[model samples]
Target: MMDEAVLEALDAYVECLFAPQDEALEFTLSASRRAGLPDIQVSPAEGRLLQLLALMVGAGRILEIGTLGGYSAIHLARALPDVGTMVSLEASAHHAEVARANIEHAGLSEKVEVRTGDARKLLARMIQDGEEPFDVVFIDADKRGYPEYLELSLTLSHPGTLILADNTFRGGAVVQPADETSRVLHEFNLSLARDPRLDSILIPVVRERVDGLSIARVKNI
Candidate 1:
């Protein structure tokens, strides 16, 4: 968490590894700009990794807990085949509309659906409706709600599903545990690692943040 300089260099390395955006990604970025949102973006490197994860997992269905201006959504959706569907939950109607335009520009409206509502409520609804389980679940939204999202997403995921949760590092706060956000995140990481059902690792990705991805198989006895 104290390795800010190294993190920056690693981010640079990630960008260097991925080539410049294709036409689709270019259009997606353009749409996000047009929508007057600037924070909704993933680094070029992370986007490529998300695409690879989808392909590697043969993901036909993905569940994204956040749809921030549709940046990460586009990254994850790029992994989907023609019939794949990425269902994202967002809390802001304004942002959801902005994400929709960006999704349209990215030509992923057919493959991704952005639903604006409280994620907790939405997940409960999804459970009740008996929706199909997802192959991958990406959690990058509200910091405090991560535990709840993780718990619910696990219910909707199969044994081999991949779960990626963002912002675990919380900018050096996780080590100090002085602030409220840091405390929760630190606990989340500790619990995830200790949980008998999970095999997890945290990778430093951005300033004050770690992409905490865990791979696990549901142990059905």
Candidate 2:
């Protein structure tokens, strides 16, 4: 097996060779750092991967469950058609404000809208309002809320909707479940794989890391 440092270097080299982060995204990350937000945003390669996934599905409408500084939202929205719509939910009003500014700075304000509130509550409200189903849904909120998020995602998704959840591996603790978060994430992964309504798989983005993303496609409803 390759050393962790070597693997990370390879990942970075691959990204540099193929999909590098652009200026707007770079500035977004810098700004997010200056604001003292958590450094938990997806990596550049992962951001490009999300864009590729969105493009592959020709997503017109996208749903994002966690909008921290709008970093990933910018990537996903960029994959949409000119008239596409993307709704992002953020739990922190302050974070939502920061995200809005970053997204606006990226010139994506016309395509992305960040809503402030609990993700679960917003998702439930969307269902109650009979909102149109999303083509792609990305969930990256609290680990303990993943199961509920997946359930709510199903309600707001149609056949062929792509659902992506990040941080599923939970730093390798998921195997032994060292804590509540890890245990819930493990259960969430198992549930996603066994769920009859979706075809699911775990995709490893980084080398030797217990953190990876989950991709699930909804079956015909």
Candidate 3:
């Protein structure tokens, strides 16, 4: 278990680095509080990274696998061009509804759409319908299904596409693999490391209990 002092120290550092919030960001933060959702929201560093990635990749088309009250999507879409598009999938209608309300309040409804359903099903359907290959894809969904989500998402990416997976650390149990979530994450991490298609890196984020940011670039299709 992580020591309380370490957790407190990390929290202090994160608070110190907390970025400035605009109307949209404030609303997303409020929605998260109102929903009492877990701390799955993006960190300040990751938020900055998302914007950088979007602009760098010219992310005209984006796909997000976990809406989580639209925190990450808002960060990403804020970086997107006026003509850019972002489609987010949330299994919980409650969360999706909150996200839509916040997106609309932020005047981004036209550029971002929050769909409610199983992410796997929704992604498969989008593929069948000929949606253009996503330029940026973020996966922060159910822990046990991380591998499946990663595999499915890879099929829709090109060399320029960026795939970011959250919570790959699973509170440091990933290195041990004693629990199911850790075991799955461990397998996923190993697979990601070996995959020839992607050049990747893992960043430790969060409190004394760390999480990960796995940034992978797909090779040419």
Candidate 4:
């Protein structure tokens, strides 16, 4: 309901107070830019929210469906315990390589691995291999694949596992759902709400525009 500029300023204010970037995060952003990656990484406030959520869930194993220059990965990995680990899937080999370098620069290589491939294939393979369930799964990949990703992620999660999806609002388009992507996202939100295995809510996140992040906790296997 607020002006866009005001919303951005509020985000900045929150970031300045609670998510101030240190050297590693700054380096990650700069290196990501140098590599010509899209500037679609989570905002600092949202990154901090991810970190806090990981900490709240005491996540030991984290799975990320998208790794864009490792910006959000750094935040999530920072929440891990010394022995905790994360596996992030990136569709672009170049993005994965950039993410690896950024993560290494952040001294988080030991805690994080960036795998390059189609996220759906990678997730399906992990499921077929009977991989250990993850404590948290962050979904931030292609919009159209969101529903499939959610289903696959559930296969990789256990009771109490936390699931997060970004850009659910599609800049407020989900309300009217004018396009295919928005309609899909709208239905995704509806499914999240009705799915018996999970309890979920969509929280608005502001940047250049209003978007949303859907947070769900698996209540039953």
Which candidate has the highest lDDT of all?
4
Regarding TM-score, does 1 or 3 come out ahead? 3
lDDT string for model 2 (52-123, tens) is 999999999999999999999999999999999999999999889889999999999999989999998999
**On a 0 to 1 TM-score scale, where does candidate 2 land against the true structure?**
0.96
Which residue pairs does candidate 4 place in steric collision?
none
**Candidate 1 residues 107-152, lDDT tens each?**
8899989999999999999988999889988888888888888889
For residue 152, model 4's alpha carbon misses the true position, in angstroms, by 0.4
After superposition, which runs of candidate 4 have C-alpha atoms over 4 Å from their true positions?
Answer: none
Cα error, candidate 3, residue 112 (Å):
0.6
Candidate with more favorable, higher TM-score: 2 or 3: 2
Ordered from best to worst TM-score, the candidate numbers read 4, 2, 3, 1
Candidate 4 per-residue lDDT, tens place, 88-192, comes to 999999999999999999999999989999998999999899999999999999999999999999999999999999999999999998899999999999999
Weakest 10 consecutive residues of candidate 4 by summed lDDT: 1-10
In candidate 1, what residue range of length 10 has the lowest lDDT sum? 212-221
- After superposing candidate 2 on the true structure, give the runs of residues whose Cα lies further than 4 Å from its correct spot: 207-210
Ranking by lDDT: 4, 2, 3, 1
Per candidate, the number of residue pairs that clash is: 1, 0, 0, 0
Q: Write the per-residue lDDT of candidate 3 for residues 175-201, one digit (tens) a residue.
A: 888988889999988888888888888
Q: Give me the displacement of residue 102 in model 2, in angstroms.
A: 0.7
lDDT of each: 0.78, 0.91, 0.83, 0.96
Q: What's the true lDDT of residue 35 in model 1?
A: 69
TM-scores of all candidate predictions against the true structure: 0.87, 0.96, 0.90, 0.99
Clashing pairs for model 1 are 171-208
Report the Cα lDDT for residue 95, model 1.
79
